[model samples]
Target: MIKQIDKSNNLPSKISTISSIRMIFSYALLKKKEFILMLLFMGLGITFMMISPQISRRVINILENNDSNTSVNDILLPIGLGVLISLVGAIVLGIGRYFSAIVGTEAQYNIRKSVYNAINRQTFSFFNKAETGDLVARATSDIEMTTPVFNQGITLGFQSIIMMIGVVVGISITFPSISWIILLAVGLFLLAISFCAKRMQIAYVKSRKTFGNLTTVFRENIIGAQVVRIFNSQEKEIKKFRKENADFKDYTIEAIKWSTILRYSGWIMLAVMSSFVLIIGGWQAYVAYQNQDLSFDLGRFIAMLMYISMLGMPINQVNNVVMNFVQANAAMIRVKEVLDAMPEIMEDTNAISAENIRGDVEFRNVNFGYTSTLVLKNINLKVEAGTTIALLGTTGSGKSTLISLLPRFYDVVNGELLIDGVNIKKYKIEELRKQIAVCSQNIFLFNISIADNIRYGRPDASMNEVIQAA
Candidate 1:
């Protein structure tokens, strides 16, 4: 039962990045109103932030130009106004973040529900082929990954872009001469970040894949612990688990390495750009001071420096935003894979619902297989109602396969399986299954009372009914 699948072969193939992103965000579209409100609040916050820098310049100008005619109120008023705007900005930003978080959380919740429902609808053959641990990972970790992308990535990323644009416009108006230098720094920063982001994306995908494999290995070991102990193969199982754990560690380290490079490179670029702005702007201010130019002064130079620093903030966020995008993309692909999987058995839309079902069953010229290798050949059988029957065979015989077909666990490839003289396919699958109960050879008693376990199929059954059934 501890079968291994080729994890590499199961890794999601890289699809169009834009298409993946669009599909992921489609879930968020349900909360578009919240998202829009978040943006509006964010815009207000950014507006205040942008205005504060200009107010800072005015306050500096007032202080520097202090004279007999200058009033104390002039400096105090602008400084107070800047502080007030900043406080309001903080409040607005908090509100924006709250709304964004709501949207993100709701989107994640919806996606999780959809995935769970989709998984539940899948036929038994799907579970046979899919790794239980891998499916669990997709439902948990993969869905979690998409949340931050919706919460911080999209909202903060857009805010960063808006802030950058506003800063650029302010800089160009205030210090037209030095604006191109700021643009050049920004362009270089983006180019470097993009290159590193691509590498990080690859690493993140590998890391996610290895994590799924590790989860699968760990789950298999846990479920098969009794088998390992019975065979005294604990050492072998431990070695196998360790190998998968090591692979996961290696992949995680690789992804972290790339992310580190991306972050530090952005920091280095910011440092260089800040130094460039200070030296060049400081030199120009000094020259203007010597020339007694009224156009360029200490206040304007300070404001320009502040604007350059503002540019660095978004540049710094580039790595974080890109990393979130990449991780979300990878997770979305896995989630989509599960959602897109086609169930091997599908109930007909016009399926008949038999009101009263008899226990009689028939198989006519049936053929079945797990894959290409047939496990059951053309055979006909009839089981009369209320008749006691026993199927005895050695291991690998069609006993389990034959009984599994009675419940339509696997549909016949070439013939009909009928129940009460009607093809089982014509019956609603749920209704058909409700009439049959299976007690597998490998009994799995849940951690509950025996009475509760017996009543599991019909919880509404009374205690008397449970006792009678027992």
Candidate 2:
């Protein structure tokens, strides 16, 4: 059986939702100019959209009056202006979307780069407990999910809030009595939002975790294909994979169910508010007409209805934005876990850098364990320069562990490991590693030229040197 390392000990402290969101915003700061430009364009688009309804109201009022003094230009001018504003708004919104895409791509790249570097920095013990497939999922699927949170979730969410505010203000100014109706509808919408958001968050997090587990199952099966074939365990592996796959599907379905309900509920609420506004506004308009009050005419009533519809669009979008935020929050948590991990081994500021080391190694009273059980105990060993030695042991023996200590793949818990008469920890990790190498029992070769493989340790090596090493 393969020895299992305690993963809990290796994992970093869990990051809270607020902290994860803060980190995402900090990452966005890397492309602050692009993000700001996108926001400005979104604001411009919303401003134009808010102005369109007023133009429509004016057109209706002019046509309703049917004044003999009015020319075609009187109606045509506002109609043309409304179209122009809409066209300009579409163009500006498109530009904003383009910038948002660029910003999202750049942010994703930066995050992946940071995560890759952080993973690389971890010691072997960290990888011993980590799954290759889970890491792959985080770097790819997780990053992809997170991009929309920054671009669509935050940016469009801000736009939605601004638009909603503008709609409320416009309605308040145009029809004060019915403005309370809009506010009441919005208040109820918020209550529904809070309840749905909590449930969606739980479902999304579970879904992401299940997906990671499924990826791990697939990855391990592929990597160990030969072993499985030899043992004729294909059926067993398939059964295990199916179980994980089913769990992933179930979790995903649960998440979709909640999100779907939230989305449809938003539409339902908007529809009800729209219908209520229409009924009340129509009654008030009829009353004003009866009283010869021209202010609350059909034109203003129609504009108020249009404004309510406009408000609904953004309110409806809140569901999508919340969904994205929940997924991004989960992905960010996974990513931040890796980034915040403390490497088991760290170089001291005062560590020395050495050159031209003699090949002398020593282990004194070494005691080590991956867990509670010690694998190496009070071991003493020494090898002189230019000497050859062999460590022979059975499958569960500590042979690999013994050799691994020379390069500090792991540090001894209670002893000193030395090279060339100085403690290995005294030497800069990179400088110390440069002078030693181990050809493992299970070798892995890259899909590159033989010359490149030979030069893997020293990319700056000349062709002649690579040939010599080969």
Every model's Cα RMSD, please? 2.7, 3.5
lDDT of each: 0.82, 0.82
Evaluated with TM-score, which candidate comes out highest?
1
Least well predicted 10-residue stretch by lDDT in candidate 1: 1-10
TM-score of each: 0.93, 0.93
lDDT per residue as tens, model 1, 1-470: 12232255233444545666887778777899998999999999988988877898888887777667888787788899999999999999999999989988888889999999988888878888888888888889988888778888878888888898888888898888878877887788778777876766666666676677778888987998898899999899889878878877887787788788888887787788778778888888788889997777677777877877786677667678888988898777777778777788889999988658887888899999988888989979999899999988999898998999877888888899988889999988888888888988877888999999999999999999999998
lDDT of 2 by residue, 1-470 (tens): 11121233122223467788888888877889998998999999999999988999999999988899999999999999999999999999889888887787788889999988988898998887777777777778878889777677777887898898999999998888888888988888788777776666666666666677789989888889999999999999999989878877876787788788888887887888888888887788789878998666677877888898797669766878888887898777777777887789888889987577787889899999988789999999999998998878898789999888888898999999988888988888888788877788887789998888888889999999987777
Q: Tell me which residue pairs clash in candidate 1.
A: none
- Model 2, which residues run further than 4 Å from truth? 1-15, 289-295, 462-468
